[model samples]
Target chain A: MSSTASSTSTQIQLASRPVGWPTPENFRTVTVELPDLAEGEVRVANEFISVDPYMRGRMNDVKSYIPPFALDETMTGGAVGRVIASRAEDLPVGTAVLHQLGWRDIAQAEASAFRQVTEIHGAPLSLHLGILGMTGLTAYVGLTRIAGLRSGETVFISGAAGAVGSAAGQIARLLGAERVIGSAGSAEKVELLTSKYGFDAALNYKDAPVREQLPELALDGVDVFFDNVGGDHLEAALDVMNTGGRLALCGAIASYNAEEPTPGPDNLSALITRSLRMEGFTLGGHFDLADEYAQRMTEWFAAGEIAYDETVVGGIDHAVDAFLGMMQGQNTGKMVVRTA
Target chain B: MSSTASSTSTQIQLASRPVGWPTPENFRTVTVELPDLAEGEVRVANEFISVDPYMRGRMNDVKSYIPPFALDETMTGGAVGRVIASRAEDLPVGTAVLHQLGWRDIAQAEASAFRQVTEIHGAPLSLHLGILGMTGLTAYVGLTRIAGLRSGETVFISGAAGAVGSAAGQIARLLGAERVIGSAGSAEKVELLTSKYGFDAALNYKDAPVREQLPELALDGVDVFFDNVGGDHLEAALDVMNTGGRLALCGAIASYNAEEPTPGPDNLSALITRSLRMEGFTLGGHFDLADEYAQRMTEWFAAGEIAYDETVVGGIDHAVDAFLGMMQGQNTGKMVVRTA
Candidate 1:
């Protein structure tokens, strides 16, 4: 826990932009020399670093909601760490902090670049990267703000075993959604969704076509859909949505690796015929909901009303592997790498 | 003017449902003898019966926003008529009325079935089917209520020469849209969109692929998209949309006659990456805005702020011809038949 100058930081840098699916060849591990902390600067030793699906979109050279990750730069994303060296009073040494300068074991930046964080209800530090951080906020905002999931409504969530989807299912239930439906890739995850996540029903898309299975499960018709996997999931949701349904387009992990642009849902006419609404959003402007979300989430965490799962990998060297695994649907929930 | 009954009404009824594009063989005309008007009912002499793109969707037996047209029934839609005789005091003789009892020379129904209307600023009764009735109200609701178009935002309208699209372009301009772009199928209609409809830019989709052309015209990216033609038009709009853009899904004339479900947009990932919103709506729940729309449209018409074109066929005998012609992109704005 030395807060000294002249230390070295290990980081994973982008070597080349992948045309379709990313591989280890796309990233290169490098070490950077650190200098003495300047005025208002802080040095953090990361405890855990997050790997998310949206990062796959950023890895491409194309412009998006977030700028593309520049070639030959250290990857950045959500991370939780402890301030080991600080020249600023706000982030004193030993205070836990969260930031975007990730895919590294050490981050040294101005104090303003880091946000102070603390563990809730004795949860692990990785919890900040999962249920208590952007992952949780995404689920909350998609349900309440984007899709406006009302009480007594049924919610259908695609990619239900992943970070955002898993959290969305529990949040929808806690928010008074009468029925929560989820779709996953594996039988184990399908069982977990119903047994552990309070989902009313779950679909293993690998079993039967979602087009056939969804209509059977959603007898009342989905009133709200939190979609993380687009394509066929969107088409199926369009087929069975109730009149005036709402869809929150959070991700399209299904098409992230498709080299060619994938076709969208074929039944979009359902929009006009059923009066459906589909909106896509990022967490940028909705940071104002953080205070409300944190407050409620803190209580829920204490009452044991919220549950989450994480696929953890050891060492910063495996960060890219974790990301690739998550993208391949190998991870059941939030995928994070322990950097310390 | 004869106020007495005992006349016969010429009616067109559905003989068979079209599998794709409708042809005359699917319809049959019948002459029905009229008895004296029953209590609470009125006898209306049809003045003009309207033909619209949406009628094609109703021709299918599949359930939609509006119930599918039943077999062997008169094709009901927008019709304006004069009350020739009435047992209901509210709809006395000489009253001009608009009702959905179309495809006929006369309609006899309860007084409540008709909405009393008059010409605006001495405009012809055809205005009721074009810019002052459901057509105009659709543009108003799509721009204001559904898309939530803002002042100074740019708007792009597909099918800009048709009734709803033509009306949307003018209404967007009046609502303070900084730039308005339109797309039509023919060179003549494209020229008319900018020259007569006040669109800042217009594209002939037939000249080039919309995906290639739209990005050039919508250089700043579209903020509000009022879509009447789906498929390639929707795919193009998805490509050039700005951050936080809104799309109102009004109609999909492009695929209404398709024998099979057509593939949707190929780049729906834009929905998430750009933080865009796409909504589908019908006028059923939004007719409450009709009074507000009527007031504003009447003023625009009176002040010469509205311009419209109609392709009127001679008799109800060509009603099917007019509808087929409109579907073939022949009509500039409203298409109607003089039933009387």
Candidate 2:
């Protein structure tokens, strides 16, 4: 095999498994030597590496809907990259592409697995990973399919400043929701939700007790609750949900790391009284709906009806920090690592 | 202003609210003279009264989807009765009807509030409160509407011997569920679930640990979990739920009498992992779907594709004991009181 001499690659692999919360010790930085492109294989220099809450669940060895990340393997994620070399007719060199390229500087994969991105639509490449990609689809399917969210209904979203929640709020508004309320842990996040993301209202969960603040924020009561944080936030949402409310259980970032799982508040009987519907979902489960979501999201983005934000870290070495920070609610929007 | 000479009207009122679990002392039996029927009014002798778990939440003076039961007032419930006198054209004497007659022997109400129950159907009057009424509707809506249950999905129901759970298991089977598993409190109740209600398997939760037994019973893993008891049963169901599973939250009998709300199991994070959907619901909230459910249930019952059981207590004086028995898991099915 003819080897490539100039291909650059920087990657992060899982050094060890985390017992509780992940630390920098769990990751290892490695410089990989790139191989020559085989037939139908392409080399991608990643521009933006995505860090998400779902990754934490994969770090554990327990069985889940998706398999856990094996120790010493490259930590995979959604990434936007520029094609530097290609041996396929469909994708030529210099094309911008999006793929599941772990926390890496460069990658070599079959060209069919990578989709070519075009700026002809006047959208940024990173948008492929945030508002126009899995994050956007997650919000769409969870709200429309799982929650059965109807137009003119009020919505409440937890972790409202993060990637999926941010996309969810804007998408909810575009779908003709009457009102959208969001909860984040910081004042800046609260502000970002309402002002930048077009949320009707946003609350800083840290400043006030969520149980009390939820009712005040949702005076008319919530019709749909999109929960990303599952501990106290779920209980608060349960308290304020109106009869026949739909709770879209998207994520539970709040309780991912404890040595023992935290117990939810004892208002479960409310389900029977209000006739609420709470559901959990993953983007991978709704792959069948991808085409439909992509069409709607592309149309919305093209019309300027929806917008997205991202916090891009500088290098692959900082991918672990970015992942950790995202889990700690430190990022304002979608957290991504730039490796190229 | 003519008044009836008879003092045959007897009512049971909430004497005092219970602190944790209710007792017989919380109820009071009272006899009052009947009033003359006003315009559009009907006087009915209640034959059967329903004692349900939802009533426990109503005793509390807090804001809920349904109003709380006022202290010293008759406790309200769905009851079957015979109209003795009427001043409205829609309802006439000797008509068998269904109405929300609080725990009372005789009640006066507008004729519009009651629905005529024709004996032409061949179903018993008590079926209006159990399989043919709200209890059956609860099961239908939870499984079909809320859970979006599909054919061949494996179903696990808690409180499988109770009115709602019993109906849910049978309906799930009739809807083409591949396997229906149920958990009840007694060995005899478990037998009823399998032999009578058509559940593929049934386990007496009081006899063994459900967490261990659940995985064994649901060999293919559970796709829809119809939760009636919400403490450990809910937690156990969460553990075994398949990817994209849906949990229909019907009731939480386990936590109804809990003085302090029990903390939910630590395994709730599984919601994110499995992409499970858990929703709480009340039959009244889905009233819009009732007509459809009624039609389906009637056809199913006529075809002998479904069956129901009820534990009837004879007389108003036995109402409290019957309710206590139902709560203590003594009743094999719905607990109802027949008053003369």
* Candidate 1 Cα misplacement greater than 4 A, ranges: A1-6, B1-6
Per residue, candidate 2 scores C-alpha lDDT tens digits across B16-71 of: 98888899999999988766778998888888999998888888887776899999
* Model 1 CA lDDT for position B88: 86
Write one digit per residue (lDDT tens) for candidate 1, span A224-273: 99999998999999999999999999988999989998778889999999
lDDT of 1 at A239: 96
Clashing pairs in 1: none
Tell me the tens digit of each residue's lDDT in model 1 across B137-225. 99999999999999999999999999999999999999999999999999999999989899999999999999999998988999999
lDDT of 2 by residue, A1-340 (tens): 1234247677889998898899999999888777677899988878888999989988989887778998888988888888778888888777899888678888889998898875635666777788788888899988999888899999999999999999899989988899999999998888888889999999999998899888988999999989888889999998888888888888888888877767776786777777766767777767999889888877777777876778988878888999999999988878888775
Each candidate: what lDDT? 0.91, 0.85
What are the runs in model 2 whose C-alpha is more than 4 Å off? A1-5, A120-124, A288-308, B1-7, B37-42, B85-93, B120-124, B288-307
